[model samples]
Target: MSEDVFAALEESQQQSPESVLERLIETLTAQKNYHRLFDALLMQQKHAMGLEVLQPTTFDNVPDERKKEFEEAYIEAARKVGNLFLDEKMYSDAWLYFQTIQEPERVSEALSKINPRTVPEDKVEGLIQVCAYEGANPEKGFEIMLQSNGICNTITVFDQMNAQLKPESRKKIAQLLVDQLYTDLVQSLQYHVQQKMPIAPPADNLRELIAGRDWMFEGGSYHIDVSHLNSVVRFARLLSEDDPHLAKVIELCEYGSRLDQQFQYPGESPFEDFYPAHLHFFKALVGEENDRNLAIGYFEKKLEMEPDEDDKQMIAYVLIDLLTRLKMNERAIELAETYLSQFEDPNTFSFTSLCRQTNHLDVLQKVARGKGDLVTFAGALLDAQNKPQPQES
Candidate 1:
């Protein structure tokens, strides 16, 4: 809101998206309206500059009494906007807005306010065609589109189906919809568990794997490794895109930007770990950049709120991640030790204190010492520490 913040945003824009977005968001706090402001700015940014900002429409920003009004406005705007696009259709195009919206309120309005009979014949035909799209797989389409990792275009296809069905085909289409749902679910779940890039090890038996991890290893890990946290975060975010499924996305950000980086590079510079795999997701959800302080606060909130052990570890890692990025080794070491104390798993993530936390070299005293699962990290730290203090040449 201030000219100084505006200048800061302008300056940051040249450097990186996250920076500019973050600084600009600080100004938005002054605006009384939340979702509307985001929608308006994002609409302008996307249309004017071709920047795709996913404007969040969460109810948290709206006042209690005004929530219903905001909801109506949002749905009405979305429908109107969607219809505006449909108006450009030369022929029949189904009014597919009803199907794409999953919010109970929007769904009810769409059902009550819009009628299939009122839609154009060609539009009805288009709806049927979209329903039949191989991707939509009509039978399973609606559920898939609503799931955590559900796709949007697929939902649109289903909406189109809903928009154009005749009384005769309605029952048939409904049955087909039920049948394909199971099929699509199977496929989507498989896709959710599989990875291709630098592809992860086969999730040969994910059900068993996730289930087998006792209290210490279950929950937060989701059976993923430290290296894959970013990819998971990115994919999770793209799947949910901030609509309550947002929590998972944020978790990934905390893990990668704060936690995993801490474990991988003990006592290292923290700035190196700022690119939470889901920056794009955050950009889309909040439409504002969170500063270091705010980001740190989010991490703290995560740690406090998370009840699961693995998730808690992930949160701990995030603290380290932030510390490492900020080049706060002493703080990072303290946090890391605290984290290690929680789960005593030397094989997975173990690091000795690098600073002068104590004058004695006893930090590595707990090293597992090469009885098979002893990590090589102990050796690396030992060698680095034992190297005699340098003498003037």
Candidate 2:
């Protein structure tokens, strides 16, 4: 039957190949031989147009009108063959044709039709890839992999897909994964709250999920987001508290602080949104039994960089007190003198007294003498002397 259609093409050189192809198509249509019809039409169409048959790359050279006409017909034929292959339980063959047509839905449907338990481990990865590829319903792919293999398998595929995607696509996929992680975290926390239990850290993949994403993409540069830093800090703190892993807690806090310090929170100094995270991290750093020096170092760094008036004073006070208690007198005096020179009085009635109490007399005397203002320093000293220290309980 196929031979008869090609036989007529020899009848005339004057007749266009399109004309001959059209007649062959009519014959195949009349006989309901759609399978051979698609091939004959494709070959004649490509041959007349000087394109390589079955070479999808040559599709670009074809005019839009012609491309659309054949794309529709070819996709339909591929879908028919794909569905037939699926019906015959030839999932791999069905997947190939369905994927070639770039119909994600049908490809997903074909994969879903297979008995997952029977799918070979090696082939399952490919099926997972097909599902997760761009426009290939990654969320559905994730579900399928999770159901068939496990969370570990799904995560492995996701990690691979994330690595393969370009920046823009990777960013998009990263956000999707982040949203998914956030959703899961929230749901789990909500369940814990309802059960009157403490909220626990999420699966370890939460870290992997966020590992590749830059918190901010501005002007083609990647920047960390303080909120993401805070989330990590909180995660670390929660785990540390639950398990009392001081070393890991310190590591997380230090990392969070470093990231926080590196990123200006997109607005004013001493970002209001970041204050809680920063405060919590500081507290966690100090809260550990043996890392007091780490806490002092963090506070000193904060004082060195802090620009906000109140924040600087607050940090100076903490740093000065820590230094004094640790008997690091040289650094303590240096910090006090610096603070006295640049620090704006925080408008609290007792801020001078607080400074006087936290700092040693020698440091205050040196600052006062250096400023050539004995009178003001004298008043501060008098106030400090007059204010009785709190009695020990």
Candidate 3:
């Protein structure tokens, strides 16, 4: 069997790590064992500089002192190889080597020393790979690329990395990209509002960004941030004020509402779990358009979506009132009867006024009679008989 060269050397003398590394260099060179020779060179360099060389030992099995010693040794060895690479003007190689060090600040240092342009086009991926290693921030590495290469070059390199990265690494890259996009969106919207510029362009830009990737909805945490969503709602409202007919406002509200829907809160409470911004937007939209059908349609859709009992009741009332005003008495009475039937005490909903306005006395009397509350039914019948019908205009 081939002997383990470094292990044998360690038993022969109590040489400092550096001296042992120097001896290994001499022996590996004499043997011309290039494969093991390169490994020895990197290992010895780490040893000589007191950098940790990662070994396959279990941390639980190792004593604290030994763990500390190995860590220190690993860092030293890594520094030696990195410095050696630097001296040879191999900045890219040096950066890749230093990335193996567990510390982030040192990796950043190695990245700083690299000349971005000198990195061969083929090596761009390798550079990005090292940067995306666990502790290193991918954005900081991209910044280095930006400085060395232009934005066009940096983006091209980023696309390549994104296509061939690990899932975790890809997620990190995605997060950094989304964060920059969010910042730009907020800044652009703010500028548009401050200068009182036409909001359509910024609003369109925001919609595009939101649709650009799903990661934007993450909002830098586990759940979506309501504040971030509210900002978009506020921007849409502002745009609506400037151009009441702006179709983009409706689109923004829809998109924001969809985003808000994906968030889950801990409780069953409607106020805590659901967002009301979209409702407000829809209400404002209905008022501006003054289209009776649109108002009716919006309220009906909202009534379908509202899960809470109280919210449903409120939306149903609005819908029934709007229907009465439009003189769609049959439809209004139908909706009122459907909703009022859900309760034991049907009179509690108090549909008498709605019946009187819409001339839905017969339907109300039927409902009142079903509950064995004939007194209320009798009054509705009497009112219907006494009231004068409308005259044709």
How high is the CA lDDT of each candidate model?
0.43, 0.53, 0.54
Instruction: Give residue 283's lDDT in candidate 1 (0 to 100).
Output: 41
In candidate 2 the C-alpha lDDT for residue 208 amounts to 32
Comparison by TM-score, 2 against 3, better one: 3
Off by over 4 Å in 3: 1-188, 191-252, 258-328, 341-349
lDDT of 1 at 164: 47
lDDT of 1 by residue, 116-142 (tens): 445554444443344344222233223
Ranking by TM-score: 3, 2, 1
lDDT of predicted model 1: 0.43
Clashing pairs in 2: none
* Candidate 3, 1-393: lDDT as tens digits: 246765667854585656676777678666744334456765654444455644422234345666776566546655666666656545455565566674346555656566655777766666655554333446556755554554445545656565445444444433433343345445654454445444434443455544544554545322224444443333232222234333444444444554635443222222232334344434544454455556566667777888877777766765665566456678778888877544433323467767766677888789889889878889988998998979999
lDDT score for candidate 2 against the true structure:
0.53
Q: Which is better, 1 or 2, measured by TM-score? A: 2
62-103 per-residue lDDT for model 2 (tens digits):
777688876776677677767766675555566766778876
